[model samples]
Target: MHVFLTTERLGLRSFTDADTDDLFALDNDPDVMRFINGGRPTSREAIREQTLPRLLRDCPCLRTRSYWAAEEKATGTFLGWFEFRPLDDHSPAVVELGYRLNKAAWGKGFATEGSRALISKGFTDLAVERVTANTMTVNAGSRRVMEKAGLSFLRKFTGDWPEAIAGSEHGEVEYELTRADWQQRR
Candidate 1:
């Protein structure tokens, strides 16, 4: 059976090709994509050709990754998706956590709540050593979510970003928390 993680009001379940509309809606909001793509919409072709396949079967970048949809438990509304995966090219213990929620779900603590759960699972269930998240330097909201979820600021650096967003020039900030750090905080 397929399993999912549940929060007080949300269910995080694996995403499939059927979620195309929901995914499209989530990424279509210009406000949501401001820091990521400068308010541009993502093409459905990209989602189908690259995003879905990577989140589902192909793990060319990282192995054993799972992409889950955040469904409102009460209404079964598709809020967005959260990703739990390893970040390393060769090592799988260095897990990473990320989320992209609809505008309706923003400012509701859903991001922080979901991220905390992913971090816990990465550390306890998956026995992962590190869990991290990143965002554009200007994305204060995202940085706050990672901090609220107990990740510490790692660093800021520039890389060959595929699509240059409005704030990409400010660099990307990495926030991370190790299993040991989580344990200590607990």
Candidate 2:
């Protein structure tokens, strides 16, 4: 297993083709997918052919700009995933921090723990200058996680999403933490 990082209760690892089922299950949950897809489930075929291949090919630590599967250490249960990657493949200095956790892991501090760890690693170890994240304005839970992860609110803006969801009219909020700011916090 290619373990990228670990926290008190979670292990962040590179996603493999074998993680397809876990990713599918995480995406299929209505509550889990609520903010992301308006509760729509991803089809198995799409996961098998597109999502899985894309994730494996872009495993975070291996390729700089990619995703990491988050798992529970003790039970080896798949919680979800955390993304700590540059805004673009060409720019390694400014990374984006994001996470998606199973509904079962909600309210358990796993997101904050994993995210804080990533931000620390990014600024201190990966030479990341800034880290940013975004979520719909109505996603209070996610916003709270961002705040707890040391990212401060930067702006509220609209995005060009393909489909309109329930709270699309409210726009999205952005949060960020710079390396200097992180150093000050530390």
How does each model score on lDDT? 0.82, 0.87
Overlapping backbone residue pairs in candidate 1 total: 0
Error of 2 at 84 (Å): 0.7
Misplaced by over 4 Å in model 1 are 58-64
**Candidate 2 lDDT over residue span 142-180, tens digit each:** 999999999999999999879988898899999999999
Q: TM-score winner among the candidates?
A: 2
Please write out the lDDT profile of model 1 over residues 73-176, one tens digit for every residue: 89989888888777665665787788888889999999988998888877787767898888988899999999999999999988678978788999999989
| TM-score on alpha carbons, each prediction | 0.91, 0.95
| Candidate 1 lDDT score at position 2 | 38
Candidate 1, 170: how far from true, in Å? 1.0
Error (Å) of candidate 1 at residue 129 is 0.6
